[model samples]
Target chain A: MQAGGLPDTNQVSTDPLRNEVPVTALGEASVETPTRAQALLRKIEPYLYLLPALLLVGGLLLYSVAHTLAISFTDWDLITPPRFVGLQNYIDAVRDPTFTRSFTNTLVWTGGSLLLPVGGGLLLAVVLERIPGQRVLKTLIYLPAILSTTVVAAIWSYVYTNNGVLNETLRWAGLDALARPWLVFAPTNTLAMIVASSWRALGPSMVLFLVGLQTIPPELIEAAKIDGAGERILFWRIKLPLLRPITAVVVIMSVIGSFMTFDLVWVMTQGGPGRSSETLAVTMYRQAFIMWRMGYAGAVAVILSAIVIVFSISYLRATLKRSAL
Target chain B: MKRYSNAFWPLLVALLLVPALLMGGSIAAQDDPVVIDWANDAAWHEAGQDAVGEASLGVTGIGVNTVIFTSTDTYQAAVRGALPTDDAFPLFDWWFGYRMKDLVDAGLLADVTDIWQGHIDKGEYPASMMGSFGFDGRAYGLPKMINYWVVFYNKHVFAENGLEVPTTWDELMAVAEALKSNGVTPFGLDVVGCRWCSFIWFEEMMVRVDPALYQSVMSGETAYNDPQVVAIMEQWRDLLDAGYFSQPGDFSDNWEAPFVNGDFGMYLIGDWWTGSLERAGFVAGEDYGVFVMPGITEAGNRSLIIEGRPLLIAANSPQLDVALEFADYFMSVEAQTVWAETSDINSPNLLAPEETRPGHLVDLANAVANGEYELYTRYWEATPPQIVEQVVDLLGQFVLDPAALQTVLDGAEQIAQDYWASAGGE
Candidate 1:
């Protein structure tokens, strides 16, 4: 009934079709609703059509977000009803060394996840564009994308195992010392997982870059060639700038994927060699599900969600500006 | 409009009958069988399906749905999520010990005491196993199998190297030094990234130190930083530093390759590997053999670690009636013989005579029957799940680098203290 500050809906004509033709009322041409009930119906008709859908989507989303935020302030195992302990969960998370390690690892994961996939994808897209067996190369590289995360993790971990493919290759080449257990130690452990994930991620990113590459007109490249511009100059000055928008999207997706990563890391190392390879997502899952500390887990989830939102907003703003240009 | 109304009546009738038709169809389907869902790890999917099929053979109007997950961790994760809901499977497989008790306390498990008591009355299972699956005199699960840890050595290799099954620490060490001197890896300690199995030698070393201490430690009565625990670490460090172990990889089934080729000599692993060793083409009691791990001294204590897998029924399942029927059949001697043959496991069913089981399995069964060794539950499932998860990593790390023993042990102590404190120092 309050309708906020919306314009005078009380004047709405229930007989919308009939009211478009002006009726002479009290010496002036004006529209009129014969009844208050009819006017009210007209005012609320659009809302009636929209209410079901809005309640379905908006209500669900609002409840989920509010519930998550509320849980972040409490201490609950998944089995027990949450008990209010405002700010304690957050404070504990801040002081926990494991959380700190997980955060740092998450940053490392995000950085690697973005740079390698995006860079490799762009390079592959350009190189394959001119190559003869382009279809085959792209198909082979992209095939991993169709495989499930479980399959990819399984295959890659086998490759990284002590006597697995990589080590065997090194041994066959007589470089025995070069083949350390790629997944058993830190820095190397995280890097190895990144390589595996990048393999699976590179395909879709390349497809996006390929689409962006198609948007560049051939005449520009021909013109650059006529001006004695080399391939490096052509890419650095013209093509690279043109690809920024697609690149931003790929980078953002990769970063988001890194922040939300759980499957491959879990399959490969289970975030161990003593939590050395744990990203925030893995740590959060271990706390909530494995350790049964749902509230603390919720706090970590909020922190992760905040990081993702901030990055997404900044990237989206820049992308929008770039598109506008 | 007149013609359309004529058509509309038939359509309306059909639409109205849809619900009735569905109800009738579901009723017809229900007449086919009562469905019992069995959730377990995919590693045993075929075995489980086979066992269920064999068990269901004389029973009528029953069908079992086997839902197998790829791994234990993922399966446990899914089970935990599903436990609080009515949509959970009626029957699932899990490790028994403190974990079972935890669920029993949480009121998540069904009271399977009737089936358990029936099995005992039939003398199908031993009292000890029933004890494992129960707390406060109410059983929650049925024991599937127990895997006894023993030192499996290549009989041919041992014969060729002029070595005997060592029965004391001195002889074991001398044999290991001899194997190393001969350029053969003495023990296959390969557990690259896998958990739970990495603690085999750790358990061996602990029980060797003092079985009572090991039991107390598992119960949280003894701390990880205890001097006896420190002694276990020092001894483990000495053995590891001697370069007596094989090149440790993620050796799941690949262990066969080195064992057959004689590059790997002995492995103090669970009886679960009996099947794998057979698969590796080793003739039991001829080409390969099992020996109890030697005691620490010439005259001292010795113990046997018994690891069992249990099948539980979810309390919230609507199909619990059918599931209980299935579980009863699963625990029978008739079912267990087929189960033992099909899955190549030593089922703990006492009614399944020793003569019917595999030779290597019969050996341990006889030992248990003779009361030749003291029994202790496996440390992996005997203690708290969280503590096991934390310490297994540290134990695995110690295998990689023995110098970190003290640091790892101290860290384990801190984790234990924190966990137990938050658990109200249980």
Candidate 2:
């Protein structure tokens, strides 16, 4: 069998208890060949073990996706029965100013995710590798990641309010001009939410990178050092290249996560100040739940899913090709 | 691919079918008591469920099961999602007017015209109230509770400032000026937490300025940026510029301590707010007093903005007769009184006893009943919900920054135009 795949159960085991067919029982009973029904049952036993998970994934996950796709081609408000409208909902989405704004904001959020969470996380991981009291520093830096997203959003909202701690501190330091309500304005509102999201995401990203750094062979670094490689050169030429697999995982997660961000934005600004801070997910939620435009929301969901799927496929293909070397 | 054993497909299907069959259990047996599931969003009234259930059960053979949702948004979503299926609640609370009209138009709500007419004939409910819950000459709901929009003020602060409740447009402005001069914020504006609160002043002032214009705007006959509406916006701007309003506060059902502690001299809100104040330990008529807002024009005098929710019966409910019987009982004065007392809110029934309610609410109810004031639906319920939701956000922005008045007004007009045009009303 391939590495990490299921074990080769056809092989005999030295331990009798561990063997699927007991050697003693076979010898003592002078076992005859199994009947067709018994052999068939034996062949299907492994599949029986997999049935529950298959059903759950098929019944709920696949059904929901298919249902959403079907609904996207219709016009439906919760109050009225759905009417097939071809590509009308998607057409409406394309023409909508709010949808355009949300799409742009979503791109901005993704960029922010790349810069703050992924970049900062790597920087933190590298710094921790050379720092004293590394364990304490690592724990402290990773603390916020363990919090629930809603709690993080709520805490950050309090910090961003007009009279909240951030503004109060600014006022105390005579930076009164900077003390505007951080969550009530457009780009600033979106940025503030991104910062909150990054704070929560940073810990996990840092931890992953730390694990990646540790997995690097110390002997390779020693050889590079012996060949006169300095700290920066060692990291650039050797350590960074070795961390590609973990980096791929982190980047993929951050990309999909930034695309699907909703709860933080919803809790903090509700995409408000007149839909100024809305991302695509926020727009989808508002359309479906608040406006009761289920079909339009389904279209938004489908578009979002298509984008994420495309990104995932292209990213995995590139990363896997590079990693295979 | 190698074909699976013959038994595999059937086994998989049966395993999947087991859960589906369990979830879609057989309908209740004939001997079971008809349980009427009543979905509501009023978390505060959860304690009163047993009393309400007992009262309704005595009148109808059905038992009541009140399911209280966390918030209005969730409740609305849940009710709409469940209405088409057998899992639908037999009854639920919903907003009146345009909000209710959506459900009525979809043929989801049971017709209650006969029950309404019966109550109207008995003089238990006013005939005029029927229009709010009716469409195409058919009533689809019964009023669960009603609240009149009134200005509640701190009596001690008013007395300290030597001001009485103003009765005219000029007098009200003068009172506000006096309160401001005395170093008290003239109004308590709650817009942050309770999103719907942002529409209160807009609705209140619009009706006060010109009730006809307000009605026209709501009906899509007049643009929100019409010159008349601009004039009202200017008046509101002047108040903001004069610093007559306090910083916006979060106004949940439990957050009445700010107003009770004299943070603002007056608060213009629905009479239902009295419950919050009372819960915060403010005694009605002694600690505070209520007054109907005076008109900006002569047309505004004695005009009150009213808001309420109605209890609707699902058309496809299995216990249709029992649900109807309970609804009929709900319309009776005794049932209304019990519900009002238990919930601590005003009942829609005109003949319900008022002794149990606060003195201020009782007086307002009397004034409304005696035709001392003309009633206009609250803006939230008066206009299409889709427009209202977007417009309220604009209104909130305007509240935070009065300089955005023109932008806010334009945005509102656009939203209104879009909704009206799409609905084929314009």
Candidate 3:
């Protein structure tokens, strides 16, 4: 009677356990069960949340890239039927001396902007770390960045004019021999424009570097000091290695911005002094809007985008690899 | 994929939402009155608005939304961008050939031939004035004003220097050399606005070489670097090197002010410049005098470069009847006289009331009728936009560095050849 009672109890417990089931059996049964609204919601909730942004960004990317690419294939003047010309536009662009000059100008501009502004910013951020009144100085340095590009161009135009403040100051200081039409003279015209660009760009990179500098732990510096590392060694090994991500971001942004530069050059130079200062973007605008050659201009735009994308991808890859290391 | 899924529907909705909103707005706009937007240079704002209002009131009895577009450059760009869309201004000021041809080719310009012919038969305007606005024997626009580029020298400066207006090329260069020696730049030029100043030089050179060649070159019949053209460019280079010309600076600098203030000896510009000079407190004939530019050849052929500004109607506009009616009313003697009086512009309508014109303008108008002249379409109007830009930029560069004369000329020739080839040759 006692053994039968134990077996009966086990059977009763086993009934509940059978209903509950093993984890694997439960998983299998759930697959066959008509999923509840709550279960479906659980499955799709994340997707529902992401759907809007994905469609938005995807649509924009598709429209811009596709429209530009399509335009490159057709000789549409914006006022006429788009004549399909296949690869003729690309061939014409390659043959154009102006396009060649613009490509060179873009490369020089990107290289110059990166080396000068980013280098200057890193040096400035390091120096500013120990300097007092940096907050005020930083504000002062950033003032030019706050001004609109047009305003900067206007002020700089006057400064670069033959009879303007720059020449006036040089003449007053007995450097009259150095004074010339700074904006009209070749080689100097390109340099003068770059200087104006650098003035506007310096503060942003400086600010970025300052933020990067702060993210660096004080303990690392103290540890380097304990290891008898000099200030230069601490900066080169500890600080710079840690700041690689920010440096990469600054360099990449400056490169892209330099390639896309148009407004300042348009306002100040109009890609003139015999198209000496014409960049790829300006030439593209002239061809597309002014000359009404949409297909050729689109080809130029595509080439520019490819160049910039290549630079961005390379930079990102290098950054990621460095971070991994 | 999971990350994108959450955003996909919302983004699709938003993407669908924007265009819908824009379409809704556009449809709403359509239900409203057919609003006609008009624009022009700020300098002519008041006169333009008055003319537009008078024309619109007399015809459609509805006011147009007139925006005074600032800066000629900006106005050109805005009109260019808007012309491709159906939202272009119904009527706007445009030069002939360059922009007009593009518009006409695109069928964007309303055929105002019937209206123009009606005005022509009524003897309201001269047939000669229509030459600029007509292409393929059809008029697409109405000429509002005709101006001749005459040399305007400061009478006070010329008298002070004991110089009379030169009548020949040799005498003109002599005056220029003398003016330079006297520490006064012989010419007042705004070369920064490349087309504005360079156009005068181009016209003068073309006239000097051969009037036929000028027409032939502009009509794509002749090369730009012909021996005769090269000779003219060399002469221009010599002038540039001699420092007889004003420095190319900001175009907005008071180019005429230096001439009026006795800082320079002469200024070659359109007769419309007299209005600006007068407004600046300089009296015509007393402070300045207009004369034909000296001839380059001993044949004593004196010629003036004439240009016209015309008003054009958009082709696709639903209000075509109203637009033509407005054009006719605008060309009427009463309106032309009103514009001439207020703006100091020479109305193309020959019947412009004498009382409405300023005394100096009346004299200039009479000169235009009697003078032996070649109507010079704005340089860009005669050339493709690409060639025009290249030529102007090259001219500016030459002004900066005169040593690039041959290179600039060669480049211009190449551009001209390419342009002609593209146009299927003359």
lDDT per model, in order? Answer: 0.80, 0.83, 0.76
* Better candidate by DockQ, 2 or 3: 2
| Residue B254 Cα positional deviation in candidate 2, in Å, after optimal superposition | 8.6
lDDT of 3 by residue, B1-426 (tens): 444644766987998899999999988887754456656765564665576566556555645566677666577767766776667777788777665787787778888777777877887766666767868878888886667777888888788788988877888888888888988889876554233355567667677656767777777677777887778778878888889887765222356556767777888877788778887999986888877777776422555576767788877666666666677777777767767777767677767776665566676566555544545565666666657877877777777778887887788888888887887863
DockQ of candidate 3 relative to the true structure? 0.22
The candidate 3 chain A region of ten consecutive residues with least summed lDDT is: A12-21
Model 3 TM: 0.84
lDDT of 2 by residue, B120-160 (tens): 99888777778778776788988887888889999988999
> Total clashes, candidate 2?
0
The fnat scores of all predictions, in order, read 0.24, 0.27, 0.27
Worst 10 residues of 3 chain B by lDDT: B190-199
What stretches of model 3 exceed 4 Å from their correct place? A1-61, B1-35, B39-47, B59-62, B67-89, B152-171, B190-199, B248-265, B270-292, B298-302, B338-346, B354-360
Cα deviation in Å at residue B337, candidate 2?
2.4
TM per candidate, chain B: 0.88, 0.90, 0.84
Candidate 1: C-alpha RMSD after superposition: 7.1
Clashing pairs in 2: none
